[model samples]
Target: MFCLPVAGIGASAYRGWPTRTGDIEICPIQLPGRENRFRAPAHTSMDAFVKDAADALQPYLDKPFGFFGHCFGARLSYGLSVELAARGGPLPQRIFASSCLAPHRGGYFGGGRSGPFTPETTDEEYMEELRHGCELRGEPTPPDELLGLSIQVLRADIALTCGYRPPGPGGTPLNVTTISWTGDTHMRPEEMDEWSAYGDVHQVLLTGDDFTHRSAPADLLQVIADGLPERTGVLTP
Candidate 1:
């Protein structure tokens, strides 16, 4: 499984993920401007994100593999899959999109931006969000660990998410599985239907399960395993 990182999550997020590197390998898609790889500025657009991500992950495309992405990462996986197909390369055998709604759902989350954030907010708000700090009252405070780590990468990612107005409709010519919290605030149950545009869409509802796949490793493993036949028959070494 090629694990794509969610917004504010780095490749290191998969560290000690309760599994071995043989049966399944999690390749955390390292976006530019994140984690230890941070040295350059970040892009605020989806297209730019795809271009940079594809380039960075080019070396890993030596074989076909299952792609897994949650929330922001899900969008990246779809984009990467499409881009590779467009370029006549080894396409992804299966794409697991989690936590996010359909790409074409305009007005998602009450539509439009929620107005500007206070300037008091850090320049990199995405980084600030994942800060391991406990909130006292409603104000955000950064923890020592987060402060020590470079967060500009996360901030840039939020800028991209905020600025995005998903273009066109959802339709990827690839096999896909959609997983979401049945009661998730961000994803609507109806939105899962939109995934049919991508061909062979399987929707998994974690009715009471939390966001973390670790919450149900057995189930996640089954989904990954079910994908193998399609992958084995279709994807080359």
Candidate 2:
């Protein structure tokens, strides 16, 4: 399976994941402009980004593979699944999404016309937004230099998410099972239920914040293990 990180982050965001999840090789997708790919320009468009990701993943598609993404990465993973199917590439056996609303749900940051944060948004305001969302934990906030860099990456990420326009009605639903792993403390049951429209839904609600992927990696991995289909060839240790 390939792991995708949330916004303003890269593959390192999934550093806590075990080397392998069951029989699945835990390959984390490192988006550009962060971590090792820091020099690469951040993708500005989701469609173009997903296409590039799909092309880059072609060689790895030899075996049964799947995707796991959180927050901003969730939609990207979904788009990749759709794009692969459309491009006659290997389709995923399953899609694991966390802490994100379904595309049709459509209300972003209170469903505003313009997103809560934009490229022009002041650095101070962006930091405040992060704090208001309770996303900044740990003592000793990042220094201004690092924080400034993070804010730039974050703005680019926000642009991708905010610019995303969900597909219209009557779209083709994926055949693969979709596991919606949401933190019960953060997402409503009803809101998560909307994922069923995408495919066979196996909802896993756990105790944590929106940061379940980070704070409770083990519990989240267990959920994935339990939901792995027999055909997925997940080796139990």
Candidate 3:
């Protein structure tokens, strides 16, 4: 499976996840502009980033792989899955979108600015955003240079998500199994139900907040294992 990271983070965002789970091999997506890719420019839009992701993940799709993402990353994974299908390539057998609502619903991180973050966002406003991010991450606000970098990448990601446009009325639903996992404290049941518009949806309401994917990976793993196809006696990996 492939795991995508939330805003202001890279592949290391999933550092807490177990290396191996049953037949599942957790391969995390390392987006540009963070961690080892710090020198690279961050993607400013979800559409563009997903296209790049699809191209980059082509080789690994040979097996019955899956996509998993948390919060902002969930949106990215969903977009990538769509991109892969559109490009006539392999599609994920199941999609696990955690701690987020469907694409059509805008996120809490973005405050009206659906475009790139510029000198436009005042210092105070940006700080507020950072504080909000800290809350979601369940961490103290970063300081100095680290804060600056986090704001940059996070704003870009928020812009992408806030500006996302769902298919118009009557648009066809995605032909894949989608699992929406939202924390009981983080999102309301009504919000999680919105995912049904995406496809055949299964909802799992767990006990925790937005950071549950990191805080309780073992529980998440069990949920994933249950959803995975049963080859019965054999473990593929």
Candidate 4:
């Protein structure tokens, strides 16, 4: 499975996950402008990023693979899947979209706010939002410097998300599995049912708060394992 991180986070967010679960090998994609790629510029255009990502991920498509994306990463994963399909490239066996609204759903709602956070949003506003999310997840807030960098990346990412508009009427569909947490106040489980519009969707309701997916608990891992094929060998990139 290729794990895609949520907004304002890097692939390191998935470091705690087991490298191999059952017959699946976890591969977390590291986006530019974060973690080890801090010097690189973050992508601000979803279309451009998807196009480039489709090309870059070509080598890794040799074997059967799937995608696991949380929150904003769900949208990114969907975009990449669509792009790859358009290019007649390999497609994921399945997509696990966690804590994310469907593409047709415009804007975002989180931290008691609706609509995407614009570039006009002040630094303090972004920090307060981030702090609130961490507090809700019962996690420690990052240091000032780290928080600052996250805010920078978040601004660009949110722009990409906000600028994105789903295709009209009959958009491309994929094999989607939507996972919703009962305790996730940010994105209600009922709202995620819209994912059915995209493809054959299997809705899963887990018992945990919003950030529970970050921990990679047994139940979550089991859910993922059940969704994948029983093939052996390491899936890369």
Task: Tell me, by lDDT, which candidate is best.
Answer: 4
Q: Relative to the unseen true structure, what is the C-alpha lDDT of residue 67 in candidate 2, on a scale of 0 to 100?
A: 79
lDDT of 3 by residue, 1-237 (tens): 788898778888788887668877777889998979989989887788987888887766767777788768877877887778678867776778886666766644323424223335765677776677677777877775787787778777766776667552234345333334454454555655667777767777665656667754567788777766832332232
Where in model 3 is the C-alpha error above 4 Å?
107-122, 128-141, 168-186, 230-237
The 0-to-1 C-alpha lDDT of every candidate, in the order given, reads 0.61, 0.70, 0.69, 0.83
> How does candidate 2 score on lDDT?
0.70
Per-residue alpha-carbon lDDT of model 2 for 1-237, expressed as tens digits?
Answer: 788888887887777777786676677888888878888999877887888998888877777777787767777887788788788867877777876677665534314535446556899988876655444444366566767777888888877777777673346466333334443444555665677777666776666666657654677777766655544443221
The regions of model 2 sitting more than 4 angstroms off are 107-110, 113-121, 130-136, 168-170, 175-186, 230-237
- Which 10-residue window in model 2 sums to the lowest lDDT? 228-237
Ranking by TM-score: 4, 2, 3, 1
| Selected candidate, larger TM-score, 1 vs 2 | 2
* Candidate 4 structure quality by residue, lDDT tens digits, 64-181: 8889999889989988988888888688889999998888775544322464355578999998888887887778988889899999999888888877876722577788899999
Which of the two, 1 or 2, has more lDDT? 2
TM-score of each: 0.74, 0.84, 0.81, 0.92
1 against 3, candidate with superior TM-score: 3
Winner on lDDT (1 vs 4)? 4
Clashes of each: 0, 0, 0, 0
**lDDT accuracy of residue 203 in candidate 2:** 72
